[model samples]
Target: MEALKEVYSRSFFEQFVKVVKREYPPFDKNRFFELIYDQAWPDRELKMRIRHVADVLTQTLPPTYEEALGILMRIAPGCRGFEYLFLADFVELNGLSYYENSIKALEMFTVCASAEFAVRPFILKDPDRMMAQMLAWSTHQNEHLRRLASEGCRPRLPWGVSLQMFKADPGPILPILDNLKQDSSEYVRKSVANNLNDISKDHPELVLDISKRWYGHHPHTDWIVRHACRSLLKQGNPDALGLFGLGNAEGIDVRQLVTSTPQLKVGEDLIFSFHIQNLSNDARKLRIEYEIGFVKKNGSLSSKRFKLSEKMYPPGTSSVSKKHSFKPITTRVYYAGQHKLSVIINGREAALVPFDLMDGNP
Candidate 1:
């Protein structure tokens, strides 16, 4: 058999042992990492390991918040997805000074790599401050910070936070979004586009506003709009539904299905449904999709889109009340509005209806 030491570098393992020993003298590094890395059941051992790490941090660091924050920053490379939760708790519980001192470090990942669970609590607790900080961050010459402001708040940030509530209201965060919509950095602009795509779910109006406002202002902004609304256009939106000259030629019937909760909390299920019919007397290969508006902290709507289904429809046939389920995310806060949801069939046209996501047990 190969040596156990062959799997990882001697120095790396030594450092790992050193850090774990310092923080959790009793921790079994091998056992802990095995559980943390196990691909089977996710999200369980992660939290537990994170707790151990935090407890270690609590013990190993000096009492002063400054010292703790410094140590935390030094240890960022060790962050796993679950350890981030521990960090969030640490910040929320005792990191006023750390929060103040480590904006750069936090922004480093908050802009691009942070877990949504860790990200949302920060914004929920203090949105205005977060907005201001993000605004200033947007202005930074560092392409990273600029990208973070757009990426972190994106409604559909892949593998990052998905703030559907902000997808609805997006008011407080709108300025920061708008600021970066036309940013100079391509890296930042891409994040801006993805962010707009996320917002398109709950607030097509705002996305449209951005598209119209920036249309032809620059080739870059034009690119952003087209990308941001790709799904909408593909879904047969009259405006965004047809950039490729495909319009709603064949007439169709439509209806709204499930509406959102009257009041949606941070962690809840958002379900919606729609009824669609192909009227033409021929078998038609059509794609059906939807955009849902989420409420935001400032009582406005932001939007995000999801694909409902795609298939060929026989004449006089209708897929009615097809239901789709989604989970409300942490970053986006819901607000009350004449929340609109849209369904698109083929590349032909779109049908619209309105609903609400409210506070409920579910």
Candidate 2:
């Protein structure tokens, strides 16, 4: 697979230069190319390349911030995609001092490509003013702008700078979320859910309160509440589980829990099977999950939970079988050692089983 940074290749820049030249005839395409392909270009990563492009634009575009932004706006609609995020990055890198113009530019550019990453610096510079603007954007006619209202203020927006102030006290963000809780677009609603999810990491109680109030009000709101409380649910928060009627495992049983292999190897699958019974007479909601105590570098265990099933179980037994692969992936390293797996029903651990992992054959 090609590195994402390769999207800013010479081919992309050729098209980019043509559009910019069409809008602003004086655009220094020669100088732009020269600077863009400088000594440090090849080594720069995706974000670094974006910032580099934004920096190059600073030199090739008009000297004044507003003038450069105007040219960008004219060419923005012609440019689109994740690759074109640099359009917004230009405003973030150069237009911080020009608040009114930068804010307007971000709004316009977001229509072509999201300004989610661009708007955070303004939020940091003037929380009160930027948040007021975000509140106004919450009701914007453009769904992109409405989505930006929630996405831009995310405390821990991935690949974007974290907003410490909002993470510390997300009071201002709540009003924006409230206004957008029932937005018409799923794109906008997903951002609202993500914003709430980010908030939940720091202020679980606050999110729980909001989830409780919004759960049954509207279908959209219900979806948002459930998604927003995912982290809390994963942690077995009683309040979070109760919202979905997934209560404690009072009348559940785990039987015949065993693994296919006495010992396993990396890049192999660990096949396991078990039986679950609802011992009670009445139907009960059961969230069946598995926990893996992965062996760490220092011989300690890092526990991770994965959901298997979540539904109502009647007074009977059901056989279950599943397999988990230990494929080599960039994100996690598999350590060769003794490991354990367990069944968790409704947030309660039911059965314990141990397995050994050996290094895969080279």
Candidate 3:
């Protein structure tokens, strides 16, 4: 499979130059291209290339912020892919002197490529001013700008700088999330959930309070709350589980638990079978999951959970058969050692079953 980062190829740079020239006829496209594409251009990574493009824009465009922003605004309507993120990058690179212009540029540029990452520095430099702008943007007519309002202020945005200030005190972000919680756009709502999820990492009680206040208020808000509380649910937080109708699995029994092999080589599947009997008089809502205690090189177990099912179990028994592949992938490496598997129902764990992983030859 081709890498998504490879989208910032020479051809993308050429197209960006073409758009710049078409939007602003006076732009020196040749000089801009030359500055960005030197002898070692191919060797540069994606972000480095993006920074190079921003640098080239700084040199080729007018020195004044407004003039450069005007040129960027004109070219933004034609931008299609991740390459256009350079527009917001340029604003971050050069627009600190004129904060208002930079914010406006971000509002426009986000429609093409996300300005979420670009807005972080501004928020860090002057949180009060930038947060006020984000609050106003939460009501913007454009969904992208509205999404940026919440996403930009995330305490732990991936691939972007962490907002430590928010991590310490997330009170300020509540207003922005409140304004966007009922947003009509799923795009904006998902961003709000993600922003709240980020907050939940540091301030779980605050998120739970918000979830208590907001869950079931509206269908859209309910969905947002559920997604926002996903981490808490995985961690077996009682309130979060209850919010989703996943209560304690009363009178539940795990029986006939069996593994296909006690020992298997890496890159093979571990097939397991089990039966869950609901011995209760009333029906129970069960959240079934499994945890694999993978043995690490340092001889410690790292537990990884996978959701198996979330359904109602009547007064009877149901069988579950699962196959987990230990194929070598980029994200995780399997070490040959004794590992453990266990079942969890509605936040309760069962007795662990041990297994052994071996190298292929052994």
Best by TM-score: 2
Ranking by TM-score: 2, 3, 1
lDDT of 3 by residue, 67-182 (tens): 98898887788886676788899988988878878877888888988899899999999999899989999999989989999999999998788899999999889999999989
Query: Candidate 1: worst 10 consecutive residues by lDDT?
Result: 1-10
| Candidates sorted by lDDT, best first | 2, 3, 1
Error of 3 at 89 (Å): 1.1
Model 2 TM-score is: 0.94
Model 3: runs farther than 4 Å from truth?
24-48, 359-362
Q: What TM-score should be assigned to candidate 3?
A: 0.91
How far residue 266's Cα lies from its native spot in candidate 1, in Å, is 36
As a whole number from 0 to 100, the lDDT of residue 191 in candidate 1 is 76
lDDT of 2 by residue, 1-362 (tens): 68778998789899989998888998888899999999999999999998898999988898988888888988888887888888899999988899988888899888887899999999999989999999999999999999999999999999999999888999999999999998889999899999999999999999999999998989988888888988888888999999999988877899999999759899999999999988998988888899999999999999999999998878889899999999887679999999999998878899989999999977
* CA lDDT of each prediction against the hidden true structure: 0.60, 0.91, 0.87
Backbone-clash count (model 2): 0
RMSD of each: 12.0, 1.8, 2.4
